[model samples]
Target: MAYLLSSERPAVAAASRNPLLAILRWAAKLRAERHQRLAFREMLEFDEARLEDLGLTRNDVLEAMGASAPQAGLHLQRRRALRSAIWLGRSSF
Candidate 1:
């Protein structure tokens, strides 16, 4: 029983990591699609409810897409500022 439990631990950890990796991949795909100037209708094909289950709101997706737009220079600046703050906070050890 102990040996079996130990062997299952890595599988359990990998399983837990899968959802996070999936969300990251989905986000990357969504960002790439937005950057490619995909139509809103095409973007909407991505299941919003599934993204929501991953803790991302529609607004979050919109914001990410907006920030990624080349013409949205101001939004990109704000995102850089926010990202710097986040990294700063994480580094405050």
Candidate 2:
């Protein structure tokens, strides 16, 4: 019997040594990505009028979905409030 011992190996090799850990990591990543994709899909369900009401355009939603930014929701909420204020002002005229 012959054995090759190496003191240094790639991190991937270490991960391969523990298949369970690698599988768990992969599953966690997949779940996170799935949730993100679902969020985008739900955004896509909104019609143009609904998006306008939310003070968001299709492009805004698309950009938000493409970029993983936690502030996107906050930005959209601000826009919605601004639009609501503008609409109220116009109604008062």
Q: Rate the local accuracy (lDDT) of all candidates.
A: 0.56, 0.72
Residue-wise lDDT of candidate 2 within 3-68, one digit each (tens)? Answer: 546876665556666779889998988898778778767988999998886777777767776665
Best TM-score among the predictions, by candidate number: 2
TM-score to native of every candidate shown: 0.27, 0.48
Clashes of 1: 0
Candidate 2 worst ten-residue window by lDDT: 1-10
Off by over 4 Å in 1: 1-43, 69-93
Worst 10-residue stretch by lDDT in candidate 1?
Answer: 51-60
C-alpha RMSD in Å of predicted model 1 compared with the true structure: 14.1
Model 1: how far is 61 from its true place, Å?
0.8
As a whole number from 0 to 100, the lDDT of residue 40 in candidate 2 is: 69
